[model samples]
Target chain A: MAEPNRSKDRLALSALGLFAERGFVGTSIRDIAKATGLSISNIYHHFGNKEGLLLAILKTASERLLHELQEASNQPGTPIERFKRLVQTHLQLSRGLRKEAKIFFLDEEHLSPEGYRANLKYQREILDLYREHLLALQEAGEVNFKSPTIAAFNILGVVNWHLRWYRPEGQMSFEETSREVTEFILHGISRVREP
Target chain B: MAEPNRSKDRLALSALGLFAERGFVGTSIRDIAKATGLSISNIYHHFGNKEGLLLAILKTASERLLHELQEASNQPGTPIERFKRLVQTHLQLSRGLRKEAKIFFLDEEHLSPEGYRANLKYQREILDLYREHLLALQEAGEVNFKSPTIAAFNILGVVNWHLRWYRPEGQMSFEETSREVTEFILHGISRVREP
Candidate 1:
């Protein structure tokens, strides 16, 4: 027999793929059930509702990211090293979780307010941790920017836009893109005054 | 009475605002007529059909963007200066034609294939312009990236996503965000290699 949890995992993954393409309002439990070859009853057994399933997916990814961040923050050589590791880990995690990221971005708004707020709390915590790291780098004279918040948004916009259009089949490996971004960011913010 | 053509222009602008928020499918000719106080017949006379009005809006914005790009490119300056000018012009243009930009980003697929192709052709031309500009900058040592295609997308993503979340009423002006982005892009690519 198929592993009991394996069927549920496959069902959840299929649901995520549909959610990414059709959007939350445009999808239904019947759609998920049809895609996964499971009865609607089985889908309901796995998830209380579409909202509960979306909540489960989002919370799972958030925990993965948060655990990675907490680990990276604890084990690091330098501020720059830590920042670069954060970028690297983020890129790899994003690549592996590309489908989930799409749903996380476009469908999170569909979650009920209480569920939405709960997910956002974890997301904001992630941003805050990165902001603190960048602040430390700024304090150390390693980088320069006028406003850390705007700068943080710029950094994130540059990185996170990858989810919208990045293709794994592209000419470069995920490593190359990560390296390029980190190099550009570190070099871009180098603190030397004009000669 | 206001000049009838002046009224026609106002009618088109109001249609753009409603379409941006409600999406093309969610909006209807009746809604546009109600919003503009023009009978559906009057709007039909001016724009031919609901789809016709959408295309007219698309054409107006695309032509304006193309004209601005040509003007920016014609400016006599270094490639970097030309690029910086392009960024400024684009920011200004997006701010002025925000509703149109929103429609293009959010619902271009709703346009007829012929209309969508027309819209995309202009977009491709503008994207190629940016690609060419960056290639020339790489040659001139003003900018360098491992992947110019990805870098261009990253830069444009930062600029365009502003429409979704930027506060026109906030402390930052359109020009200020434009300048900040220009600085960020240049600095993100500064030539000095510092670890």
Candidate 2:
């Protein structure tokens, strides 16, 4: 049982790397087998097919994100603080799961019909978690945004776009980058004075 | 001249639609020819190859965006207002050129080595424009953000992410949506009291 599970993990990790580099459509099952030193039959036995591997990677990615978000939401804080925490949490996860996050954004459309629907369900849940925090902030008279839905997306856009530019080995550390993002989302670029 | 230009336009438009739908790698010259009612040889005559078609589409998209952004930056306004105009202009263009924007984000990697560098140069110019406005605002003491580079990217992320969700027949009009986005970037979700 342990040996088979190890093979499955190897296939998933190899597939994730390939999918990130070559994209899902461009990466073939044989490529995954080659990367993992596993036979084609073994890959099939583990993942059923390439689409199955994609779904598994996506499911793992979404589940991890959802878990982190849920924990953030449950943290004790004011609505605004909690919202900031949620944004920070998202940034941290994106940085850590950079490959998975890239696949989430780029290759989601390649999922089979049923897999696409399942993935959408996970995505909507993530969005709703953000929306819920914004709704709470609005109720507390802390935020003045027009639509919670739009506001949620705007915040997500700011965080998710970091994937394109943020480099760990680059000048700015993740700490600095995430802080700047959180502050920008909360107060924007305009100078605000405390009452 | 007229006949040749029309053929080029038709080929470009058809290629844009196909690339957006099937992706750059998934799309072939035969597909473009079929969509435009032109032979494969005709496509080759106009584009030289599929990569050439992609480069043309990207060039047109980037040029139009730069033109609008340039106009916005030169407009008579305070730095903040000009920045808002830039954001609004970006939103409008993204909405108008939805397919092109999709291709820009998803298919850019498929460009040839030279073409990739050219596209990157265009992208950098656009980013620099945003940074310039933010620098002006920062110098004027109208805003206080850590890094103009990160802030510029944040603003772009908010605008570009809209392409993923914004719909014409949806509840929010482009005007309302763009306005909300601009306001969000300028002031964020926090309630700001007038000084």
Q: TM-score, each model? A: 0.80, 0.94
List candidate 2 stretches off by more than 4 Å. Answer: A188-195, B189-195
- Put down candidate 1 lDDT per residue, B1-195, tens digits, no spaces: 657587678778888988876767667888988887878887778888788888888888888888987797769998888888887777678888788887776566556788779878877777777788788888887455766776676667666766554678988776666676667777776565444
DockQ of each: 0.35, 0.53
i-RMSD of model 2 (Å, 1 decimal): 4.1
Q: How much does each candidate deviate from the true structure in C-alpha RMSD?
A: 4.0, 2.4
Residue-level lDDT of model 2, residues A60-138, one tens digit each, is 9899889988997789987777777888888888888899987777776667789889888988998999888888887
Docking class of 2: medium
> Please, what is the whole-model Cα lDDT of each candidate in the order they appear?
0.73, 0.83
> Residue A181 error for model 2, in Å?
0.6
Per-residue lDDT of model 1, residues A29-115, tens digit only: 889889988888866787777788888877888888879877877575888788777767776777777777767655554567898
Model 1 achieves a DockQ score of: 0.35
Q: For candidate 2, what is the DockQ?
A: 0.53
